[model samples]
Target chain A: MSPQSPNTKSLVEVRELTKTFNGLTAVDHISFDIYEGEILGLLGPNGAGKTTTIHMLLDIVSPSSGNVLFGGKNLRHHREEILRQINFASSHIAMPFSLTVEENLEIFGRLYEVPHRKTRIEQVLEELEMTSLRSKLARTLSSGQMTRLSLAKAFLTQPRLLLLDEPTASLDPDIADKTRTLVREYQRRFACTILYTSHNMKEMEHMSDRIIFLNRGKIVATGTAQEITAKFGQRDLEDVFLTVARNG
Target chain B: MNGNRIHALILRHLYLYKRSLPRLMEIFYWPLLDLVVWGFITVYLGQFESGLPHIAAFFIGALILWDILFRAQQGITISFLEEIWSRNLMNLFASPLKPGEFLAATIIISFCKVVAVLIVSVFVAWAFYSFNLFVLGVSLIPFILNLIIMGWSIGILTTAIIMRYGQEAEVMAWGMVFIFQPVSCVFYPVSVLPGFLQTVAHVIPAAHVFEGMRAVITNDGFPLPELMWASGLNALYLLASILWFHHIYDVVKAKGILVRVGE
Candidate 1:
């Protein structure tokens, strides 16, 4: 699918967002807009502020001197209201281990206050191909299964904006490819906007509608995958990432 | 706060308790052991005919009441610790669940657990030792309420510390309330303490609660003043603890440590 037009409404507007720890800035003055129904890829090296920025967008991390407006509403003032329409998934995050997969989804479904919760949960499980594992405890699932469960939770809410942090990091190649396709299909079906991050260059090019590359807490480049590759005078995003990491 | 969100959090913990035998056993095992041991001690003490009248009531009642505070605090702290241990804190905060709603759920869970502990302790005390906790009459309501609030205050404070400092501060989850036990006079009178320590005990809500509990047992008349002092102190401490938690929450967010808490 092609990227959303510039004229498309902005679902999230991050203005001069910055975060400092002690004297070191983890996310320096940075800003971007995630257009509605577009998958915005946040690409960066190991020390980049991609996760920190995602945390700020989720309001789990407070910016040093910036604001995030979701659907034209200030996140600080309307955190609960804004968050209700958003969901996040990360390989580094997890559900309650002792709870079964279905129970975990049930809790999140209720947390998001989705209408017809039981039916929604069943549908989400089936969509994620986790129907057979619904009764299995979270701790007992393999890493790939855990990843799918996390994705199931993200899709369970049908969130207006989904923030995914290296969500396929733990999945095998086949499962990862399927997950990418699933995400694309979900976004297409529901017009759900996503802010996705990953170290997989080919996957980034395949999944992101527009890519924002960050280095040392600053955005070094932002454009479509081909545009970014051409702008950096590199063969692909992998080369561009190397150039940014080594030369910047 | 939305009731659905609060119920979701409560349900999350309830599922954990429902599935794990160890978790369910924890709620009854420790309290029952404490009751059995203390019941024997009280019985042994009764054989001596000491000047302390109703020695069984004094010891057994104090043990049961003390469990109320411990279990109440654990209900909140351990529930939160479970999230941390499971690496699920980020998922929870990232959801629409507000901090106030989260605390409210823990408070309700604490109440339920406290009731469970109370039933087991009260019944076991009556069955084995013929000690009826209801002898304190209606005053039992305020006593339990005050202890529960105090437990919540300490639990919230511990949770804030753990949230900010991560696993390094987790020791507070188990140890923070016990620090109050020395000053709380859970078994002895506050008069046994040094002057300065006595002054310190006066500020603690649990201290007044235990003192009042003893008064009620000894028929020294109703402990209206002690109850009022405890309620007033609990009001102040609970407010202060909640404010402290909010402040720490903001600081953690600013420091960008919320995402690193479980790690």
Candidate 2:
């Protein structure tokens, strides 16, 4: 059985969650809901606060005035408990440099308190086709390889809610496709609810149940792949993103 | 952070040190410098006093304890700066790990380093200057609180500063260690400081730590009140530092300092 199958009910509900800097509001009171067994992709232009919103939802950035609910509780109140049930992967971050991939996974798995951590680590390594990279230091991994390791780490927590911030950002198209495939496979097999942000429109259109188009930190539009493309009078989701960025 | 996670991070750092070159610098070279440079000075002064009864033994312990506490202070936030340099601070912060985990792991790791430095410095003192912490080990518990607080306070304050200014402010983390080493009564009594500076010297917490250590070793027993005062001062520093750190953390995080720093 997959880790997420049991929690296929509505698992995350972000409400009017806003974050600001100085006088400028960054994530301006955006509200969204996420259910289990589905992938929701967040698409936005640079500086649109897509990453900021994700950071707040993951408890990385504190909200200015609103609540982010996770597993039916306010995230700030049950922060650790909520965190224990979620994991995140991003192309933009890296783990410890001195530790090998295996060691990094060991530390995170131990932190995750995964039962039979060694077996799980091996499982992830096998699944990701990364067993050869296990003993390699994280700093030494190619960007593509690091992305894979990050997905492995995200899978470690066996989280009900998995947040991916441009997990394939900066990857070649082939690797990006493979990365997306791996993430989708993880979701399909584990039934993990993925809250994702991606610049790659095709990837988002392919994977998301609903793609949220965010502009100036608010969800300007959200719908199925065709629903969004038709509303924006665009051929694809990428055009919708451009319309939101330029006109929203 | 949960207990198991904290334990896991602490063990990871400890294990990392056992496996890394920088750990060697912390565990071996840096403390060796403390012992050798200061050991020579004490040895040179030895001829003029030449083991002035048990008083000389107390002074030897005073020096060793001084090095340990200062290094304990040094260990606080410098590593956090390294995290910024390597851009790993955000990675850890963004993880499931909480702020408290970073603080606790830092303290545990710094304490371990301090213990290692103390052991080596004591060996050097006992070998060359007849100062034996072995005889004074019973009084170590009170001393432990003082150094641990100093280390944690320095760690928090440094983390705050690093969060604001990145790696450039890292030296400020260790600034007081070498800067205050001279007047902290590490080498001599505060009485030796020219009148006004003596009063100023007494205010820095390590002055009290050294004085308390000297009292324990020479006075033949632990001085509970004085040690408690030292610990209290360290606690106050730790509290203030943590508050300041959290404030800065909120500000920078809201402003996306973590992202800018990474860029």
Candidate 3:
């Protein structure tokens, strides 16, 4: 039986999604459904198609042979409508460099057409604790501050679905823990689905309600942290990840 | 296309220009220097003016207008390139912002930059050499409009190429316009080019614009035929460039080039 066969209502249904680059398959015939409000952790070693999957979800990359349905509409046909309900952020992605922090947030907020934009911008800034740096140019921001700004932009839209790629990759341990807790709180408050990725197994174990383990463009395992560990008869998710990486 | 989205994109770029002094300098400095150098030549040549009464006016006027074309093209291409350099293209496209709206914003930004540069270039030319661009009178409006549209056509085509081929094609942003410069007859009449090149020049909108400017300078009455030709050519090229841009945008999305562009 397929992991996605359960009748849980899904906000995002990725059906047979595949991608190839110069004859090399980057994402190979992957299928999954992101539930309405559960946190789905996408786990894979480097080159295992994590980023490619995220890009496909965002329609930044088109699939070679399949379709992605966002909120029951084909992404190819209703990209703008579907994108309006979704927001994404990554430490790898940078906002405009020369624009100030406030300018960047205001611009993105307007693009998303958030209601009551001025009030929302101020609210997001206050939530992120970035009121002091609002005037600073993006080029002058430290990595941690930039990540926070990226988060601010993501939260500004108050999206129904949020895609976060390595959201805590650049932060210190304490902040990383804090951001994870904040993300959890926001997901509950907004009732938004989240698709998150990270290399830190312990962090993934703590935060993910369910996990998908991918290897070489294929999903090698799928279950909760405890279930996946039990499948490999491992002590923890870290050992289970090691076992998959070594044997797959 | 959404107006608010387009305005937001334009405002995003305006902040870059507003925050940096060097960027502002780049907009007005080069054109001013070009006018000054050519103004001195115009004065020196006026002493030997056995042919035309206001040869200096022709040189200075043509220089300022040529910069308008160059600036208009650079405005669109450079702004698009900056997004790639900052790795912000993915973030922008991932939003609800439509591709058409993004392109519209760049075109609007190009117009703003051209206007700013034009005012400064015209001011410095008049202050230094007393070469009044207003000498062309009401006819000057159409002349400027035609040149700016042609610049946008070239600008859209360059941006399309960079989108399809990636940053390796960036050099074309600065170099593409010049390929048409010699044939443009910006400093001379179309009659000066070789027979075949003149045939080639006739197809370019800029050639007709400069020819019309010379006619107005020589008090030959407004050349309606030249203006009509330039306007017609601009419309055709602008349509083709826009179509080509949409095609390239689809190709970029399919190939996933947007993700790797800045790298």
Highest DockQ against the true fold, candidate:
1
| Best of the two (2, 3) by lDDT | 3
Q: Which residue segments of model 3 deviate by more than 4 Å?
A: A1-7
Residue-by-residue lDDT tens digits, candidate 1, A1-248: 45455568899999999888899998999999998989999999987999999998888998889999999999999998999899988988977889999999999999999999999999999888899999999999998889889989999999999999998996899989888888898999999999999999999999998999999999999999999999999999999999999998
Tens-digit lDDT track of model 2 for A35-88: 767788888898888888878876667788788888789988987778878888
The sequence of per-residue lDDT tens digits that candidate 2 reaches over residues B15-92 is 567677876786678767766776677666766856554555555566666666766666667556556655566556
Cα error, candidate 1, residue B66 (Å): 0.6
TM-score of each: 0.98, 0.89, 0.97
What overall lDDT, based on C-alpha atoms, would model 2 receive against the true structure? 0.76
> What's the DockQ for every one of the candidates?
0.90, 0.44, 0.83
TM-score of 3: 0.97
DockQ-based ranking, best first? 1, 3, 2
Local distance difference test values of all predictions, in order: 0.91, 0.76, 0.89
Candidate 3 Cα deviation (angstroms), residue B66: 0.6
The digit string of per-residue lDDT tens for model 1 on B1-263 reads 89999999999988988878887787889899999998998888888858888798889999999999998998988888898999988888888888889889999998899999999999999999999999878877898899999999999989999999999999998899999999999999999999999999999999999999888887888899999999999999889988898898889888888878888
Query: Across all candidates, what is each one's fraction of true contacts kept?
Result: 0.97, 0.45, 0.86
Q: Residue B20 of candidate 3: its Cα lDDT?
A: 80
Across B167-229, the per-residue lDDT of candidate 3 in tens digits comes to 999999999999999999998888879999999999999999999998998899999999999
Superposition TM-score, candidate 1 onto the true structure: 0.98
